[model samples]
Target chain A: MSIRIDQLPRDKFIMPGTAACPGCPLLIGLRQVMMALNGKMSLVIPAGCSSVIPGMSPATSYGVPTIHVPFASSPAVASGLVSAVRMRGNNGPVVVWAGDGASSDIGFAALSGAAARNEDLIYILADNEAYMNTGIQASGTTPWMAWTTTSPNGKTEERKEMALIMLMHKIPYVATASIAYPLDFIAKVRKASQIRGFKFIHLYAPCPPGLKFDDSYTVKIAQLAVETGIWVLWEYNQGKLTISPPSAMYKDKSKRKPLSEYMKLQGRFSKVGEDAMKIYEAKIDAYWNTILKLSELYK
Target chain B: MQETIQRQARKVLVGDHAVAEAVKLARTQVISAYPITPQTLIVERLAEMVDNKEINAKFIRVESEFAALASVYGASAGGARAFTATSSHGLFYMYEMLWWAAASRLPLVMAVVTRSLGPPWNIHDEHTDIMAIRDSGWIIGMAQNVQEALDMTLAAYKITEDSRVLLPVAVGLDGFILSHTAEVLEVPSQEVVDGWLPPRDPHIPYVIEPGGEPITMGNMVKSDAHHMLLKKMMDEAMDGAKNVIHDVFASYAKLTGRNNGDLIECVNCQNSDYVAVATGAWSGDIMKAVSDLREEGYNVGFLRIRFLRPFPEEAIMDVASRARGIIVFDRDYSTGLGGIIAAEMMGLVPQSVSFKGVIAGLAGVDVTPSEVKAAIKDFIDDAERNGPIRIRKTWLMQKMEGGKP
Candidate 1:
């Protein structure tokens, strides 16, 4: 049983006493990450729910020092703070926790510049499909058929390929992780912690409130997301690529779950008709095929 | 208490080197600035001092004005005493981080040689460049001549780093006027400057250093709450800096045998009915002009505004209240708004008193001793005969185009 995260002798975090909604995947994922990291890190958050989630005073949920920087200047502020700490001879890892809105929209310039300079920091983007903090506004990472606040009908555009964008920077480490697989997520965070240069981790955090999904369905929805090829898991490290084979490597057709299995659970995609669903499926197929070709090149 | 009789080495140095020597005496820990005209020589001398080991300091040659200020911000946050120099466009380029340094409450000191803002790109002196950042929450001070330039540089560290006044400071020198001109200055000994100004306080910076695994200094607060803190802190510091400035000036006065009492003044005014308010290198020529007018037996006095920011509003108000009329000799113009200093003084004085502006020496143009003399004479004559409104036609703008000749 591949060492269940709950069963491992991981150090307990003094953070997050308040319960996340029952089976809230993101909170669970964060708990696992914090346990793996074990209090040797600092977190930089922009204007996101994560910035607000840390509890008050002695009841603090974040076990480590967490700074909330401005939305657009997170990368710049992080770089400045990281340099300052390095000057003082501290060797601890500096981590930035950003939402897709911060990473892909407002903070893009600062992020690109920091990565280009190969700053020693880890940037984690918890992409919950849309901007959940502000009532599910369509963000750059929102899928084609998702119905968000801005995208009142169905989203007309494709989701921006953020992990691929990060890969182009030729960073030392870049990976995608999901709540469906806790061990895989923890493994990727641990891998990032070992790397020296700019490391990026894109975690698919499904929001029950924004996705209009049932609380118990978070992990199942995340699993179906990868199985349906809507969220592919991969890592790029110094010109090498590793794509995790689909949930069931043998019986490829059986591994390919219907798109409706993922979308039907969320009200965000309820407005999408059959034709729109077909369009969404085609875009996901195109994206996976490109990823497969790149993976082959690296192999 | 003991009677101390200490003499300093009197030297004939350009304004740039005087500033460099003062900064050296202050023993800054880090000097990060890009080279800009008039101001470049100051940093150049600082670099030489670093190389010669006359001062044990780290000198970082950054890529741009933006980076220069940002680098100092990093250094200052780490508890190192940092300094930088820039002029004109370079000063303008660091505009964004100027507010950052002040808001972050770093006691970083920068020397800005005031040069004219460009269209033709003349590299002569004017006050507009530094004046443009007046509201950036910095403790702004101007030097009237080389002596003040040297004295004020040391004073800057003492004022900015005071626990009560933890804000960035800008010490301004007139471009080519004070920047390039050589003058007699009693540069203080390194030991004396060290005694006057201590190292930066350790507890101020909120940003955490790396090994300590500290968090950066920030978090989301209510907008009104955050702004109120900025306002409350800034107001307290600025108000505190006024007294700190005076005490340091008193100490500096004792060391140099020059009384820099938050201001400099000359009064033919015991019998004189009119006064001129001016500052920087031009104030020297204005003094000569005041003497020439005094010879004509017109009751005239000269009040050189040594410090610009903290405006010395009370002193000017006191002087203007006694004078029959006032003439403001401004080195820079504010386009459609006329002279900035003239406007400021006008706001301070009673409506009963009259004043006119003699906008001169713009873009480093020569405001000769004779021209200042003539303008003062005309201002007095017009003010005494006519009302304050029509004191004199604004003179000296006639020769404002070219750089120093």
Candidate 2:
């Protein structure tokens, strides 16, 4: 379905001409998420490209109060910001928008702690696969068989499972979304504002620069990720499970595009063989089955 | 200097609970804490009070020491009076945000139960934990007792909220010594405590507001000029905290019928030649030891440091100029350096005075009044016969080597 600009919320979150690269998926994801969240939102960005995307000076696109904290402190900082809002009797929702590097790697300790404590806030991880801000460095979330400066011949392990780890905390809300599905992303973020206990939203954002793909392919790649069962859309809420139905790309599983297409676009995954691909497939299947079992148990 | 009036009141209360009561009296709007030994009582009391709606503040149970401080920082930056508590290991855990709170100029206040740093897994009174992050830009204060801890907590707000000194403060109290020991505390009326520290202003804007808005906080701006400008402001505020702390103590004195002075207090050194300088709870023992030595015709004095961070240099210099010998009792080691306080005192005094580094009571090691007396006698005898003890580098290094890995 072609998205209509008029159908989208008319409100502007980040003004035009911001520092985000021309086809940055995080910027697009942030714009929609902010619009859905509406007024009175505190954004805590940890150290990463998305954290610095607001720009330093002369030009800033974000229309709300955004604070960029240290790399490992986004969740902790957001928890503080949320408590401050509560202390001040402010009804505004506290939101944390962190990159995968900051959220899954350096920030894991703080993030896990905040979720376990059930701090009243919404934390969103804009996962662009790797640490795009630091020249496409491999992070814990960097998929297996993904190449990067450090992971010269593709990543050796499976991506870190962040959402499930947060789920173990029994948070009030935890959901996954992709920029390609704006409505789902917006709905989850907007709903997160109404909830009380800790809520997390993981957005699968495509990076043209980091992925070494054409700038215009950002949205298409995001769609392909979800449809390929590579980035599933699901939520764990109070031990309950809810998965968004597959999109058009998953209508025919037999004709589903190969994972190689996604890997071929990104420089981080330039090298891969049958052995590595098999391991990747097995990991994905196991993760998928685990999610299915969780859904069954919770349902 | 003379033996002064001591308001010796007896009461039994855990250190954490006492500090919590003080925090309550100060009317902190946000109370955040994570459970850690020697400091858990402080948060538990606040949490119970919050559960019963005894205090108007929100009590948030954070996951880690880092989150506890981060929550306080956020709330404080949002213009609410915020507080948190942690001990040794916890303090080390929150080191990063401790600096963040200070550098951002948030009027955040925290109580640190000084416990020995880990390795041997001991939970006892030691200054090493708090002193480890001394340069993290916090206005540091040492509490001699529960009452002092209570009073200093309010004083922290007075110093931090003062426009001239908008910096975070960490009020340190010895862990097992001050935290677990019970003592009679003259609990002031809520009305009086409220009057002493006014309600926090709610309208002040935070560095960051909700919903992706932009605010000029620790923003990355162009130019070294901007960098130095912020640093200069922070430096100026720290300089201003000295007078602000004194004034805050003065106001509290008026309300609570107590008085605290800056720099060092001279006890029994009026016509004496020797003085022992100490801080925190040990000062009481040191003073008693000095009084006994004075009765024996031994000219002895006690210099009690009221403020540790903005080290009262002028007052220290004045006291050292008069005293012939100085014995510095320090509870924290610098690891490769001498006792933290002893090293600091050495730099403050003139070379003429004999200085003895009495490094004891570390990691909650017991130091009784008699031990203080012995140290004082040794210092006086050395001063009278061989002159001032010459400075030694290897001794300082030896002190460092004693630190636990």
Candidate 3:
């Protein structure tokens, strides 16, 4: 997947002066995705921050056609849109831009069905850990020991492994990307755009207000997540698995940063004790071990 | 107007199958549905039809009713005629997408096999499911029998796809009673239907089309006035549906010699002393009761409330005001508020005319023609003996040993 930044289209699909907050990583990721599509994609966005980030009526931020559906029907809507587009002899890619809450909880059934059917769609699940648009409520994708309005004492359950779940569907393409690596994200989007079946990209996006971090630290937090091995960047294509750049380097735990170094930056994890940190570290290590086994099996 | 053509052969079909046949004739390009009791046969038959190339459509077997409707919404927005069907709990499950389809102004058609909502779990004839979504800004209609079920399903596409009324339409058929009971229905020729109801060309500016302008649909409206204005547009569209519905019905009648009036079907309402108002298949039973009472010098009339969403308020007012008393037989009950249809009628009917609500046939309980006749007799007797009866609601078919509230 050799691609240069200068080769990418210069037209800004996510127009300037949008309502997105300063340093919102999802916005940055969406802009890159739009650029990758080169304004040929039709977006189906469910109710979330992105639904509003496109501004209100009469003023849209998206340069491509968009349909904002209910919170739990993005993938289903995309399936129908793809079918209709094909019926009309238009085979353009149909994309679903949804959030963690919608993708992992409210819309899980729809996502699973689309994957099982291998519907022709590009589903991008932007994970900000919590339901940021609804004021930082704990979602299924929220990591363990993360404080949210619904999980004030910190979430007791482990975060949902959505990327692995997507792999279980055996779709044509399934990948995990981050806003911190724009090039990797763009390359994955370009790759997904070329595939013909259900493609899912689980994005690691950092929310400043929701995670109680300074706005400027959005990109830093996202980068640290990959660097610390807390968020792995990888792709699964045609039953083959390969880990991506920075996160791939952490397979040898000796090179991975301590979990506390990543947790200490966000106030949402301030209440995390040392013992909990050890448990989370062990869990992350176990996850990487499982990923390695999957890589071996798929290979 | 196209010239009237020779009618096609008639076939015996259940209400659910009739809806499927109509959908096939309507040339629905995309169909997505989950199987539920009573409504299952509709999707199953459609699926089989799609597989056999009987209907050139994509049948998506969705996981849930929410996705079923959402898939249709997406397909319709992408400039295709789309459809789905559900019953009772399935309709309730897809409640959110119901509003999504309507608010997005997607010209889609959904056939709802009306059934009783659950607690004890019963799948049979009841109107509660469709009635629950009457206020969801979609054009709603209730079919009297299998024939009307087929006709209404065909008319629904025409009504919903009208440039003036680009709202989703739900054609309600009674579960088990109409959905399962087979009746003779005139299945119009594909040529005639094709000539009458052409392919949908939605007037909405924002459709999912490749190479079209980048337009956003269903975006947030922060301003109260803007939000209210969108709602006002829905309201006005609904108001405009009255004419579209009438014209479509008239056009359908001209194409085939069958019409369920425009909105409300009146049976001998002229100079009648009392009128019995009902909907769904049971309206046939009410009409029978009206005829029996008229034979006994009761001078009774029957009005079938076809389109429930638009409410047919003016037509209802016109018919009910002329009658000395109006008896509304509701197949479903609204907890703490009596019957839903009766409640709506109370607001529309004249204050001077006597009105009574008879709640019956709940949980699939059979409201026999004899039972309907007896209820009408009671209402007529009350209106005759006691001028303008005070009892606004009566629970029919309830076994009460003593007087219990």
Q: Give the top-scoring candidate (TM-score).
A: 3
Please give the ranking of all candidate structures by TM-score, highest first, separated by commas. Answer: 3, 2, 1
What is the DockQ ranking, best to worst? Answer: 3, 2, 1
Q: Candidate 3 regions off by >4 Å?
A: B1-5, B202-205, B398-405
lDDT tens string, model 1, B1-405?
Answer: 122324477799998999899888888877777889989899999999999999877676655666567657656665667788899999998887788778778778899999998899899888888878877888888888898888888889888788788888889998877889899977767766667677666456554443343444444444656667777888777777778878878887776666656744555543457888787777778878788777877678888776666667777877878878888988766777777788777877676777887777778777788877877776666766776663322547563357642
TM-scores of all candidate predictions against the true structure? 0.76, 0.91, 0.97
Cα lDDT tens digits, model 2, B1-405, are 011112223345766777888788788888888889889888988999888988888776777888788878877766678899999889988988888788887788899998887789999887888878777788888888887887788778878887778788888888878888887775666776676678766444345666333563554555768777878888777778888887887777776677656444556644567777778877888888888888898878777876677667777777778878777888877878878878877887778888888678876777788877977787688778998674422121123465842
Model 3 — TM-score against the truth? 0.97
Considering only chain B, report the TM-score of each candidate against the true chain B: 0.92, 0.91, 0.96
Q: What ranking of all candidate models by lDDT puts the best one first?
A: 3, 2, 1
Q: What is the lDDT of residue A57 in candidate 1?
A: 33
lDDT of 2: 0.77
Would candidate 3 be rated incorrect, acceptable, medium or high by CAPRI criteria? medium
Complex DockQ, candidate 1: 0.17
Model 3 interface DockQ: 0.78
Clash count of each predicted structure: 5, 27, 0
What local lDDT score does residue A31 receive in model 1, on the 0 to 100 scale? 73
